[model samples]
Target: MLSNRQLLVLQVIIDEFIHTAQPIGSRAISKKDEVSFSSATIRNEMADLEEMGFIEKTHSSSGRVPSEKGYRFYVDHLLSPFRLSNTDVDIISDAFAKGMIEFEQVVQKSAKVLSDLTNYTSIILGPEVFDTKLKQLQIISLSNQTAVAILVTNTGHVEHRSFSVPANIQSSDLEKLVNILNDRLVGVPIVQLHEKLSDELTHLLHKYTSDFDAAYHYLKGALFDQQSVQLYVGGKTNILMQPEFKDVEKIRSLYSIIEQEEEMAELLRSNKDGMNIMIGHENKIDAMQDCSLITATYSLGDQQMGTIALLGPTRMEYSRVISLVNMLSKQLTNTFHSWY
Candidate 1:
């Protein structure tokens, strides 16, 4: 447990480091209006805090910076309530006020706005398809030998793939296949689509068409072969603006990890509902060990739909970012709820 004076000193050091990204000295804390101690007295408290492993001095500087443990303590105990400014509220409100109705459009705009607000990379994982039921399926013919299969979810997300039509499969077979799929698969959750097709729909397809095997294989390849998660990353270049990521090799490594959508999506999905804060080494990814990840879940009705996250250096503006993430998550949830 920290004494009141030590806590105040630690808080000041972290707040200063967050904004300036520089080590803080006791003299700086003494000069603050809320601080009533002399530099000498503040220095004593800082020494005690450092001895307790709350702060450390860089090799090049005598000034102290918060350690990862210090940051965790600050977030858990010392953070003050951060109220959003009118401008901040307006920025978020105006985004949703754009009258957009589609889930992808709303989420895309939210991701871009979040990145612009924090000047950090924002990654949003679209709702998992497992809970989304099929709204429609269409096979549009592009030519005599090629066609596109489009899948539409209840959330208005569309996935389409083009494949070569087998010579043995006629256009009439395609029509019958789509009609049967729509009739049987509509309203079925996407996660169950494959099993449902294998058990129930396959026999029906064979009864309707002589070339069932060829048509079934083609349709499966087009629709279910790769059901990758939908990931939207905004302001990918914003990491370049952070001083901590100035090293070319570090930036490259981090960018490479972010580009792997599966890894990032899985990382975000690991968080439970509500807000989660992972500081520095708490992050499991090697490239993110020097960073902090703040994640919040947005929901549709009672179920969680997706995650909104901000990635920044460990010297992140935690209070402000937490407030922003919380507000945005609620906004996203409310928007989705309005649709239902």
Candidate 2:
């Protein structure tokens, strides 16, 4: 445990480093209005803090910087509740005021709002389709040989795919398949659609249609073939503005990890309920060792629907970003709940 003096000195050092991205010396801490100790006393405290692995001296400068251990301690013990500015609140309120109807629009707009507010890369894992029940299905004909199949989920998300209509399959046969699927499959969760279709509805389809095999094959391939998670990212280039990422190779490596949508989506899904912060080496991925990742979950009632995250250097504006993420997560939950 740290005494009052040590805690105050650590807080000032971290706060100064966050704003200036430069090493801080004892003299600077002594100059702060909140600090009443002399430079000599502050130096002794700094030395003790460094021995405890909270701060380290740079080879090029006599000043000290916070280590990953230091950042972890600061985040865990020193984070105070930060208030959001009126303008910040107004921006979030205005974004949701556009009367958007689709989940994609809401999530995409959220990504943009967060990135613009914090100047960091924002990623949102959209509502999991597997968790949502099927609301409706439609098959629209475009030509004699081709048509479009639309799947609507309970959460207001829509997905459509095109498939080939063979000469052997008559229009009446296609209509019959659609009717059978709608009757049997509505209100089924997307993840179980395939199993439900094959195990339970096969006999029903076989009873009503002459060639159930062919029509069922086409419908299954069209809708159930792809049900992966959705990921939305905004301001990917904003990381370039941070001085810590000035190394070209470092930026390239980080971008590669972000571009792997599946990996990133899985990583975000692993977070526990509510807010989580991982600093520097605390992150498991290689490229993110020098970065900080903050994540918060948005839910519908008791069920967690997705995650909202911000990625930036370890010197991030933690208080403000934490407030923004916490506020946005709650807002997303409320917005989604209102829709249902």
Listed in order, each prediction's TM-score against the native is 0.96, 0.94
Point out where model 1 deviates above 4 Å: none
Mind sharing the TM-score for model 1?
Answer: 0.96
lDDT of 2 by residue, 16-111 (tens): 999999999998898999999899999999999999999999998999999999999999999899999999999999999999988889999999
Q: Candidate 1 lDDT, tens digit per residue, 201-225?
A: 9888999877988988887777776
Q: Ten consecutive residues with minimal summed lDDT in candidate 1? A: 219-228
Worst lDDT run of 10 residues, candidate 2, spans: 297-306
lDDT of each: 0.90, 0.90
After superposing candidate 2 on the true structure, give the runs of residues whose Cα lies further than 4 Å from its correct spot: 142-145, 165-167
